[model samples]
Target: MTVSVLVPSSLTREAEDKREATRKLGYVARAAAVFRVDRLVVFPDSGAEGRWGDGFVETVLRYAATPPYLRKEAWGKRDELEYAGVLPPLRVASRTGSGSDDSGSLRQGIVTEVGSDGRVRVNCGLQHPISLPEPDEGLTEGERVSIRVSSRRPVRAKFVDESPPGFVVEASDLSTELSRDDAGVRIATSRHGEQLSVDRLGDIVADTAPRGTTVAFGAPERGLPEILGVAPPGGDEGGAETERERTDLPADEPDGSRFDLWLNAVPNQGSEVVRTEEAMFAVLACLSLTE
Candidate 1:
């Protein structure tokens, strides 16, 4: 599926930094905003369900000459977080609430580079390049935000940042949560929420086969040791959850579509891979459109 390239306000500062870095390096880093298709599920546009046919893949690869910054401030914070402190940390809840209550506005920009795994470097001009806003400080970083068309000048979005990414009303399907909203279908967590419109979502599926209805909470291949208790002593045999096992599709869908889409794009099976976020977006965009 294809994830649309969007320049959020969060990366403005990073874009400035990249520009400066490029200037120092004796060249301007041109950036363009573009989406990277991670998985294609139901793309009627072209190709099979599991892969982004050569044509679509080329389209994603050639969308922009340079990578645009499509990330948020919290990305840096999460990466830089050190496990040094052992004491109880100060926790701050937003009085403004999880959803945008004037927390801040996002500026847009372009991308500067596109890696093989679909990581694109975007460039947005943020005010300061100093300390980034901290997540625990009530400042949401590039946290997953679900933005939907509300009206001419207004957009509606829900800010969620606490629950895992799946609905667990029943004991059987605790692995994921899918929320249907005006924006389309959102597979999000209590913590990070991503918005996917119908068109964008459909594009992704037609391009990349999605593993199933539920996005990967954490793929089985990359399953962590302990959770609320999904795994047992020996845990999975690494490749236990086959491509077919991972999907929630009914019979009649194409073979290998669900497995390749979600497993490869969404989860990292210990390899140095591309950003799973991009893949997640592709599938989500499809679900949203279909819903």
Candidate 2:
């Protein structure tokens, strides 16, 4: 099952500094890798942008998502990744066959050169770029491709039709992502949305797993309702209410617009504030489970 996770560019709005922001983004990347997300979209939230806007968020996420072997060549020195040292390792294991077998392991490669002789030079973090037979339609210079490496000693590898081991980072408009054709079971997560229950989660996973799903999350203090200008449940009421009361949301119809199902991933909570990264783990733990 394919899963696409959409996070606002203002995700680090609550961060106290650049270092802290980078650390927070690391966990977000960790969640994506843990859940095997196909896409990690950083949607624009111009109004709520801070010292770190779309550029910073996108750059850091892209850097974090890049495989360790290709990082140096894929992304050169950049100001946005100043605190990249603190980012946690994702450790997304290779899904290709194991043992000393000919099936080979999957590795990400960058096309350094495309030749007229139906061959292309790929840099898959080897000692040097290697040239392999061109793909059916041919590949372009600078295009990222996957290679299946059977023998590293003699360097036997071939281009393969597949994605790398980690989630791909993307920057997109919020509206554009919501309208995609493959955007199956669009879910908006919020404290004021419907409360998530054990029974409900099983149904959601079973139903949506086959078709794929897209889930959107809001930044701290600024939720999807606030971002979309849709009134939040309890309607600007005071914050002294309990979690049970906050999750006592209205019926499931997108909370008026945009989403297919509105959800309160954590129904009961002792902490009044739930950070975006925290909520991500809480929500995805239930959603991405397989039988």
Candidate 3:
């Protein structure tokens, strides 16, 4: 099953400095990798956006998602990646295999050149770029592709019709992300949402496992209801009145109703505040549990 995680661009809003912010994003990346998340999306959170914006969040997440070897090729020099060194290692499964010939390990490759002879030059984390015939039509240079190496001694490999091993990063608004056709079982996590009981979690996982899952998170200080301009449950009497002044949130639907489920995954919180990175680990750990 495919799992997508959505985090607000203002995730690091509470960070004391860029170094701390980068470190926080590192843990977030590590959590996503540990949970085998397929996609990590950065949604806009203008209200809570601090010094860093979407570009910084996307840059760090994209860099963290990229394999250590492919990082130089995928991204060169960027001003936004100042503290990338602090990002934790994902140690993705695909990167752990022995590079021996018969390992049949899948590796990510960048199409360096597409020749007229139906052959393409791919740099698949090898000592040198290898030229292999196109496995399918419409291959182009700079396009990322997956390949499996059968023999590394003689450099034998084939393009595979599969996604590469790591999760991809994307930046978009919450509405657009949730509206995607493949965004199955959209869940919004917040402290004020319905408390997730053991009985309810089983049903949630069972229903979400087959079709895929897309889980959204809020910022450091801002919750989903605040970001979406939806009044929280048992909010103040003027909550709706205040929310209506901010955005065009529909009056009929309850606050955060756009999501299939609004879960208070961390009920009885120990701390007064939960950091975004910390929440990612806690929530994904519970939701990813399999029977």
Clashes of each: 53, 0, 0
Q: What tens digits encode model 2's per-residue C-alpha lDDT throughout 239-276?
A: 32322344544445342236677788887778998999
Instruction: Give the whole-model CA lDDT for all candidates, comma-separated.
Output: 0.26, 0.83, 0.80
Q: Best candidate per TM-score, number?
A: 2
Best by lDDT: 2
Candidate 2 has a TM-score of 0.87
TM-scores vs. true structure, each candidate: 0.20, 0.87, 0.86
Model 3 residue pairs with clashes: none
What order do candidates take by lDDT, descending? 2, 3, 1
Q: How much does each candidate deviate from the true structure in C-alpha RMSD?
A: 19.3, 4.7, 4.7
lDDT of 3 by residue, 95-163 (tens): 324557435778988898999998889988899999998876768888888888877898878887777
Candidate 2 regions with alpha-carbon error over 4 angstroms = 97-102, 115-118, 233-257
